[model samples]
Target: MSELNHVPRRPLIAAFLSLCCGPLGQLYAGRGKRSVTLAVVTLVLMIVAAPIALWIPGGHVSFKLLMFAFACWPVFLIVDAFQCARKARQQRLHWYQRWWLYPLVFLAYLGPVSLISELRTVFIAEAFLIPTGSMHPTITPGDRILVNKLGSRDDVIDYGNVVVYYSKGPGSPLYVTRVVALEGDTIEIRDESVFVNGKQISEPYAAFDGELPTYPNMVSMQPVVVPPRHFFALSDSRRRSMDSRMLGPVPIDYFQGVASRIFWSRPRQIDFSVSPENSQIGAIAWERIGMPIR
Candidate 1:
């Protein structure tokens, strides 16, 4: 058999390091292009994935595409790190050159979740998982939604608009509710009718069963006074929801922002995983791939 041609140590080292953490080992072996590209990509991905991991509510990625990207990063990092070390020793590169791999490995510990949070939060895009069916038919269980952190408008809170606001106080999960009434509007509920400003507020979005008030307190619009800068809210699923009825009206300060859209929707299984590792961004419903929120 013919002898295989000899490959250079530098190329071998670069290839190996790139696998562990991308071109890092090759840089130690004195390859500029190889090292820089790996570093840049790793940093870019770390920045992107970190935020998604941090605040994408329940620590799950709302966007399937993003989660897919996040899952592959660490594998690349470990492979590249290994390759870089191999090349340096073979090529007899200087000590400091090989040491760069140490910090790069430390970065691997930062994990994809942390990196996504740090980078995405800088851009003001926050996302969280929908944990309940209160906003059903609009937002379902296990749906991931994108929230505009700085897009909340107080005086502009219009009726029938679905909003994410603090329904419980400073220490509760931000809820998604439809605005039913504005300040001093004389809101009232009876049987299944809603009267505001001495006129009924039209609620087509409210579920039929939810069309009426199901206040846990059974106050039935107990002649409540909605303070200024406060807005009355209700669950879209009226009969099944517990909103301003039980908790009272939500204040402008309690308003977080509007529910923008459903970024990703999956089957109703909290913390669900299809596979053993559940590492991959598995099958998604084709009809809802990019369906916009109403």
Candidate 2:
């Protein structure tokens, strides 16, 4: 299979493309070339390693490794582009004759990822973590989740829904919590009850047996209105969570990706299974393994 066919056709192609750009070279090579498989594998591994490098903080071994990986991919991309163009020309492909088109395509691939994620520091999922608790008993912290990097871009925040967003850091981030109130919606958590805009929201998720005004002041005010584009989020576990009551509203821009699926999970620690329910509380959480973001 792919493991047995680990070869990079154009060293310059592989290096420049993988280097000057991040993983675009491998993306271009894709399944078309013999070397494409290994390139793709490298890119994926690089992406997985990226966050650990950043989390290592400025200058650690992991960070250094990530930096090297990030720097190295574009080299492969450039080389790939050149070779692809060359091949296209030899094969009499018209796009090759344009000459300048090559760089244009390369630039397109490079700009969005580098500028959007790196410069703006937008909260995209470099990765995700498993969640635990009943507040969001629906989704435990330890459950593996895949995030859609460009999911939350809506101007109007809907109520009674699950949302994953960036909340702190330059944009402290990475969570899959539920939306309790939209901007301008007054929410009160008092005496173990919730009222939004003077009316309570119907929650099927909060199955806990107690309550108190989570945001006493904000909830008691004359129905506070959520600011445009801002959202009030809380753990389904209204009482103990350090959500909006603790950190205020979740800014829209902090949004990186929406919860997508659990590509993999290890409820058994080391055993491989479809789901914990089958594998049964912390078994493997099979039902959620490949579920999509709602």
Candidate 2: deviation at residue 138, Å? 1.2
Strongest candidate by TM-score: 1
| Clashes (N, CA, C under 3 Å) per candidate | 25, 59
lDDT of each: 0.61, 0.52
Listed in order, each prediction's TM-score against the native is: 0.62, 0.49
Model 2 per-residue lDDT at 53? 35
lDDT of 2: 0.52
lDDT of 2 by residue, 1-294 (tens): 122232334435534655555444434333234344544454465455434432344333434455567666555556655565344332322222233544665676455555544632344454466544423456654565555444346733456656666668344645567787876676776544577877776777775534444555423333445677778876776554556766777777765555544444544331123432332235666455544333
TM-score of 2: 0.49
Q: Model 2 misses residue 36 by how many Å?
A: 5.6
Per-residue error for 99 in candidate 1, Å, reads 4.9
